[model samples]
Target: MRGGNTNGPDGNLRKDVETALLRPNLTPWQRTFLTDIHARLERSGGQARLSDKQWRKIFEILGRPNNVIALPPRTVTAYPPRRQPSKLFRPRFGWVGRRLRWRLRNLAIGFLIVAAVALGQQVFNLGRGQFQSTPTSTRALQTQEFSVTDGDTVHVVGEATGTRLVGFNTPEKFSPQCEYERQLGERASSRLRELVAHGSIQLTKVACACAPNTEGTSECNFGRSCGVLQVDGKDVGSILISEGLAVSFVCGRTSCPPAPRPWCKG
Candidate 1:
């Protein structure tokens, strides 16, 4: 006689057999029987019917105490419903989501690297005097407060240290290499004094090209601080250069070029 539906709209029998296939210690006969039932259910699309003997065998393998006749009105606990995988743990969007996240992380890392390099370059420039922002210190000088040492050097009234004006070089006056240099140095010094006589003298200190402990040596402008002198809002170096009293002298990243030899003028 035909028994109850094995694979039907209820699906309990088919699901129970499928659940039994997952048990680890099932005998080979039990596994083979459950697997055959699953295959038949798949082929018949849950419409497969079993005979009474087959129904008894299925319940026996599934560890259920009921036969097909006792299955209609009772709940089947032999196999519980399969738990659905949670959306949070499942890869819903597959590889696309993972790739996008990876790209965003790389972009953030790239931005940080670029910022670090730019900061390093700025520090390097500041140390070398190749790039500067505001002056480190500013001094206002009165006519009598400073004495012109030469065309480009000056000694302030109260300070023991002298200041060498940057951006221009004048002839040597302290120990001229030639008579022509001595004469030119005198003319330049006189002109510098004239320039400082009338207008506001402002000295803006800047970084000097010298090692940490070598301020008094020739490397650090011979013990003098480096400054930019502005008189009446005009750069003293620019004035001297325009009047042919001094030649333009600028330092690179490391140090200033050798002083121009105007002593033997061509």
Candidate 2:
């Protein structure tokens, strides 16, 4: 009788109904009480199901208040544990060290090669008599035409050629009064012609002071032999000197005379 309502819609009338059953205005405490009751009923296998929106509202109510609990201090932990003193300071022999050593070796080799080449050049120049200083003038002979007069003397076409020949005195051409001298001269001349006839000869011009003869022929005061005359890398003067056909007559300020031998005197 306490639970029945006589005016319930579509129901047969019950004799007893409470006035509190029709009340709609519940207080906050009463609402809380009803919520707890409803939750208990749901746990006891009631027909009510919590949708997504209702669950979110319930979660928000249970979460911590904004100013109540402070978050733990944030910490940055490094990955891959840091090296200790011994490990951190250990020496590493890497490719960089090897590369530096190799570079140094190459530099030393390059320096050695340069030094060797320089030394070789010095030795070569010394051996070839290039270090010997001879005073040679740049004056051209007035006469360009010259003929093989004897072994050493060359006849010129004009007075200028004879003047130019003053510094280089050769043997007389076919002299009867000095027949022995003439024969020696002819022999020397023939030998020279044979040696350089078809070969290229480089004439080096020189200047000197020597009196010309009445026939306008000049003689070499420094003697006619010495110095270098190269042919295919062979020293012509040295060859003749070695053969005793010519003497090593140092010319210019250096006063070395020709050897007083029979072959060289003529």
Candidate 3:
């Protein structure tokens, strides 16, 4: 035989085994199995000596032959003899533990992939104008304007707006995708600043989205609104998009900005 039942780590199984063997009602086979198990446990320090199969032999020996559970023969090793990796194949708690860990690892990987797909789908729907709950419109709002933070982002002097120019998005100054993205972002910011610097810039809130600024650590509007920036009655978005400095987009209604993306890449 490749191996017999290993001794139990705990001494309890052997105690039960010893008590059963001493019973006067035991059949000859039962007495014999118990005696052998007791002896092996003693030799091994404190545990049952029977291999899992040998331990199971007690069930058959004690049970009426006809009433015995239909378990595999105890004579067979948990792992068949002569197999190359008989050790891992053994039906022991150790092997079961390893199998469980492997299963959990695969399950975690599956969850990550599922989450990624779901996030991607949401972005796709946003770009396709599927958000119906929030409506978009373009209206020239006359308000006290403060400064142009970037090409598309603007901040009102006294917290009056969370507005960004609709219809188009510029490269991100905070988080750029690549060198090209960074360069484009700087150029866009400069252009918008120049446009506002000269005379006056008015926002035509057209096709606006209710996108929240998520970058606020506590209380700050870091996000921009989607709208047409009206300069002398001309659309700033149209000009920038035409010049390739910005891209045509609807903030929450259309697609999100793309390029060197990690947060936006979803």
How well is each residue in 82-110 modelled by candidate 3, as lDDT tens digits?
64666766666587889998999999999
Highest TM-score, which number?
1
Q: Candidates ranked by TM-score, best first?
A: 1, 3, 2
Total clashing pairs in model 1: 0
Q: List, residue by residue over 1-266, the lDDT tens digit for candidate 2.
A: 01111122322212111222233664343334336535543454442322212222322333312111112245797799876779777677699978988999999999999999999999988756643543352122232343343444333343122212222233432322344545655566676566555554433444333344312221343123222233444545555556544554444443324523343233
| Model 1 alpha-carbon drift over 4 Å, by segment | 1-139, 216-219
Candidate 1 has an lDDT of 0.72
lDDT (tens digit, per residue) of candidate 1 on 142-227: 87887787798877665545688888899865445666776788899899899889888787777776777776654566456778
lDDT of each: 0.72, 0.40, 0.55
Clashing pairs in 1: none
Models 1 onward score TM values of 0.46, 0.30, 0.36
Residue 151 of model 3: what lDDT? 72
Q: Choose the strongest candidate by lDDT.
A: 1
RMSD of each: 43.8, 56.8, 35.0
